[model samples]
Each structure stands twice: as structure tokens, then as C-alpha cells.
Target: MRVDRKIKASYEHAIDNLDKKEENEQLSEDEFLERANLRSDLQDLLKMEEINWKQKSRVKELQEGQSNTKYFHRVANMRNWHNSLSCLAIDGQVVRDGNVIREHISKFYAELYKENVLLRPKLNGLLQYDSLDHSQRDLIEWDFDEEEVIKALRALDGDKSPGPDGFPMLVYKCFWHIFKVDAMAVI
Candidate 1:
């Protein structure tokens, strides 16, 4: 996008310079042809840029509308309503009280996650495999350098899901210099 903007600016500047030259002096056949060609090229570039801008604007509009539409909210509310537990059966009896339901859920999960196993089977000598040597272990444990971090970031697909902060790889890749220190520290 920046490159396109720069190209557009240069083309506009060239056209303006050509116009100024035409106004100042009488042009030869070749100069007139050059001016005409430049104008045509500038027009073509501007048309393409306008189409690109319109496409981007339409996409943004669609995304914004989808996110904020009444239908979207209704569907989300419907899903929440469906997922909510209004009643539960416990000990062959229906439970509707909120406190009872909460207690039942908490007790059920607590019992489910309770450590009941007193003795677990050991796998110490059952399986034998070669392990990594010192150098390999060191390589795996070493902190990432700037090059490695940049390479990993670059390797990620920019169009994939964004991180928890809602920024995509494209953002980091585009503004690496600004984010390098913070990103490295976090990593």
C-alpha cells in the first residue's frame, strides 16, 4: 500500500511537471507524445488505486456490519440462552434452584477431578529410547536471538488468527523495529 501511494505521488508529480513545461514552452512531437503517455499511465494507476480502495472499504464495511448487526446479536443471545442450564436432574429429582445447581455443579466437578489413584503404574524400564546429547539439549534450552525470533515471526502466516492482543503477525512484521524489544522480552 505504501509503495502504491509513493508510485501514485510520483506519477502525479511527473504529470504536474509535464503540465508546467507545456504551459511554459511549445513542445516538440516527441515531448507531446511523452506527456500524453504519462497522462494515460497516471490515469490507469489512479483507476486501479481507486478500485483497490473501494474494495478495501467494502470489505471493512461488511466486517463492521456483520460484527454489529442485530441478527448477530440475536444469534449470540440465542446460543447463550440455549447453553444456559435452567434445570438439572440430580439423584432422580429435578433441581431448579440456582444455589442447588451451583453446589451440584461444583461438587460434581470436584469429585470428577479428585485424585483417587493411590498408586500409578511406573514406566521407568518398560520403554527404552535414545535421548538428546548435551549439545542438542543446550540448543533446545537456549534463549532465542533476534534473528531466530524474527525468522519465527516471519514464518507465521500473517492472515491466520490474531494473537490474544488482537494483533496479527502482519502487524509485527510491518513494525518489527518498534516492537522488537518488547516482543523479545515477552518471548
Candidate 2:
């Protein structure tokens, strides 16, 4: 234990010396390279610290039966900086600006919607539907109760893509007691 402490102290002292050396304005080429290497090592240490905290917190979350896959995915995306589009092809030309990318996406989806409008079948039949039996009509138009909503929410996959509200079914399940009334109202 004493030897380990001494070694740690020596390492810290060496780090302090390197820091001082880095701040010297008259550093030689070799010293500059060494300082750059030390800076690189410091950056790596900071990255490792971030990763270590994430891993430890993940272990705690797993112990509590909470999945951290999404959290890890978010962290990985932040580290990789992949959310921004580097380039996109629009109108037979490559565009790299952010605003242009958004416009391209909007125009593309708008054109897709226009194309889909053409694909819709025209209902030419004029009131040619027969009335359903009492039970069949009741089944077709059954009202949803709180219990049914809860059951559907419970059956949903937590990892599935969220709806437009940006909330997964897992959130609904977790906060069901508080939001049940509002959810049933929406239904």
C-alpha cells in the first residue's frame, strides 16, 4: 500500500512538471511534441472518465431493472457527432447547408404526399352498404375504458419508436397512475 501511494505521488508530480513545461514559451521542438503528447493523454483521460461514469451508472440502472440502451445510444451519438447532415443530394445537386437540407426533406415528403394522393382509389359507390347486425355494430364501435387503455399500454414494446409526441409507451406505463384520466379522455 505504501509503495502504491508513493508511485501515485510520483506520477502526479510528473504530471505537474509536464503541465509547467507545457506553459513555457521558450520550449524546444522536442518539448513542444512532449507537451502535445501530454495534452493528448489528458484528453484521453477525460474521455475515459466520462465513459467510466456512464458505465458505473449503467451498472446501477441494470441493478434497478432499468434498461440504459437508449441512454447509451444517445451518448454514442453525442460522441460521434453524427446528428448533423454533412451533405444531401437535392434537385440533381449536392447541398451541404443545414437550412437547405431541411428544405430538401420538406419538399421530398411533400412530393411523396402528392404522389400518394394520386394512388388513392375513388369510391364511386353511392350508399351501397348494408346495415350491420346489433352485435357487429356494437363490436365495431366499442368505447375504450381505462382498463383497456392500460392493457394496451402494457402490451406495447418499450423500445419501439415513439409517436409524434416524442414519448414511448414505456413512459405511459410508468406514469399511468398520474396520466390515466387524461389518456382516457383523449381516447
What's the lDDT for all of these models?
0.80, 0.73
Tens digits of per-residue lDDT for model 2, 1-187:
0124454455456667876766775677886677577666655655665676567657766786766566656655565563467899887899999898998899889887776666778888955978899999999899998778778888889878898899887887898898888878888
| TM-score against native, each model | 0.35, 0.31
Q: Where does candidate 2 stray beyond 4 Å?
A: 1-131
* Candidate 1 stretches greater than 4 Å from native: 1-124, 129-133
lDDT assessment of candidate 1: 0.80
**Best-fitting candidate, scored by TM-score:** 1
Model 1 — which ten-residue stretch has the worst lDDT?
Answer: 70-79
Residue 147 miss distance in model 1 (angstroms):
1.7
Q: Count the backbone clashes (under 3 Å) in each candidate.
A: 0, 0
Write the residue-wise lDDT of candidate 1 on 1-187 in tens digits: 3237777788788878878888889878887888788889977876665566556555665788656655455544654664699999999999999899999999999999998776767798999989999999999999999999989888989978899999988999999999998988988
Q: What is the C-alpha RMSD, rounded to one decimal, of candidate 2?
A: 19.0
